[model samples]
Target: MKIYSKLTSLFIVVVLLGTLSMRPSEKKILIFFETKGYYHESIPTGVAAIQLMGQQNGFAVDTSRTSEIFTDEKLSIYDAVLFMSTTKDVLNEEEQNAFKRFIQKGKGFVGIHAATDTEYEWPWFNQLVGAYFKSHPKQQDAVLHIKDSKHPATKHLPKTWKRWDEWYNFKDIQPDLKVLITLDESSYTGGENGSNHPISWYHSFDGGRAFYTGLGHTHEAYSDPLFLKHVLGGINYAMGKK
Candidate 1:
């Protein structure tokens, strides 16, 4: 009777261990916000959208202040990093090196709105962002032309969608960027003579996927259902889900 009892106890322990080990772990994504920016409201709204998407897709979302986080070790703990409308020069030398290494290590990154206006002094970061902010024609209602519909980020979006946001002109765009969406010159004022003003794009640089969208300039933009879906797709695509 003693031997039988001991065997039953061992079997139960083994089964319990197996069940615990079989449970899936949640994926985590980190969001870094540069709080020293003009468009503060938009960033928080964007973060909320990201959190909603994370919950829907079984991901754990983490957020940090720009001046407090962004160490190499802290960054490694996440599968993806988001630069949410940050416009300040918040990163020091050590942080920049860490960030560069982070991308080289094959992770994911997303840049929204004013992210292009940041890190202008850092040449490598400028290239990573795909373009630097030159100027905006004006704050006007614009139409975003889906240049690459097959791309996971823009795939679900309509061919031409109307949105109200601050359109930006970027300077010294890197040649290798895979342009995803452009602003339709006909729908807005203030673009240079060229018709193709890239508003959103994604590229793999330094062994990691990087995505940037020039939308999200206003809180209203983030609340829009269609805009939220677009942002969600971009985040998932960057994380290799879409």
Candidate 2:
């Protein structure tokens, strides 16, 4: 009877160890969507989509609508921070500083859609996000030219991808950005950036990594598997997984 009990205990221990070994290291992401200007109704959809991506990809995701979680302690637990359609002055001076410190420590940041329309007064943030939103035409169909198909964020995309979204014309464009995608001004109206209009980019900034994509303006974009995969690739790149 004692031998039977010992055998059962040993079997349980072996199963436990096997389970532990099969588990991968967990990575976490924080989605911040505090909006001080035009708030996209699609924010909730975007958040839910990211949560789904995390679940399917074996990562963890958390969402926030306030700047309270910018502290070193709170931000420490996250592998990346993503600004999901955040607009205009979302963070206070203190929170900005905290975020700067967090990035200086080699953390990651991903920006989507209106993230460029935010923090106009903060030059550092403009550079961090890669560009400032100058203007955009009405939501219409346009062709996006994928500049670097080798990038994980753009690899799945076609050489010429046509889509309907609010196309932005940017100002204060950073010269050092690795542009992954560009807009074909001939394909749409109100394209003020002229021929070489960059739409998505990534770079290393102040000891951290940064990626931005100008997609995700519509609710349908959140439900798109291709768009979601693009965003996930950006997240993975920011998290140093790519």
Candidate 3:
């Protein structure tokens, strides 16, 4: 009887260990949409699209508009942080410090359109975003030139993709960035960056990965398969999955 009890206990331990070993690691993302300046009307559509992507891709997403979730304990729970069209100064000094620490700990960051328009006073934040939104022409159709076809973000896109959105002219463009897409100034008027205008880029910053795209300004962009693929690739790249 004692031998039987011991055998049962050992079986239970083995089963528990097997279950633990078979469990997959969870991937979680935080989508922060706080805007202090001009808010995009497409913000809700963007959030919903991202949530759907997360659901389909087997990752978890949490949305927040408040800076209170920027603490170390809170930020630590997410594998990646995405700024879904966030603008202006959104975090206080303490929260900013916590976010800096979070990035330094090797997490990921994904920024959509107008994220570059944020935190002009914080140099570190600007550097992480890769560029600042200098100005933009009216929303119009433009040709996107794929610079890096091998990049996950541009792999599925054509060499010359045509899309319409609020086209931004960036200032303080990071010289070391791996640009994935550039805009052909000839295809659109009011382009201020001349011929070598970059529209999407990614790079490793500090101790973390950062990806930004000057896309997703219009509600229709979220539903476009190619655009969705582009955003998904950025998200995957930021999460270190691509």
* Candidate 2, position 99, lDDT: 92
Cα distance off (Å), candidate 3, residue 190: 0.8
Work out the TM-score per prediction.
0.89, 0.94, 0.93
Best by TM-score: 2
Residue range 62-112, candidate 2, lDDT tens digits: 999998998889999988899999999988898899899988988899999
Evaluated against the true structure, the overall lDDT of model 2 is 0.93
Query: Order of all candidates by TM-score, from best down to worst?
Result: 2, 3, 1
Of candidates 3 and 1, the better by TM-score: 3
Model 2: how far residue 148 lies from native, Å: 0.8
Clashes of each: 0, 0, 0
Worst 10 residues of 2 by lDDT: 233-242
For every candidate in turn, the CA RMSD to the true structure comes to 2.6, 1.7, 2.5
Q: After superposition, how far is residue 52 of candidate 2 from its true place, in Å?
A: 0.6
The sequence of per-residue lDDT tens digits that candidate 3 reaches over residues 2-103 is 999999999999999999999877788999999999999999999999999999998899999998999999999898899999999999999999999999
Evaluate all candidate structures by whole-model CA lDDT and list the values in order. Answer: 0.83, 0.93, 0.94
lDDT of 3: 0.94
Q: Give lDDT tens digits, candidate 1, residues 1-242.
A: 99999999999999999999998666688888865546566677778888887898788899876545667878878777888888858688898888888888888888988888888789998888899888886688988888898887788889988888888888988888898889888888887527878889999999888999988888888678787777777777677663
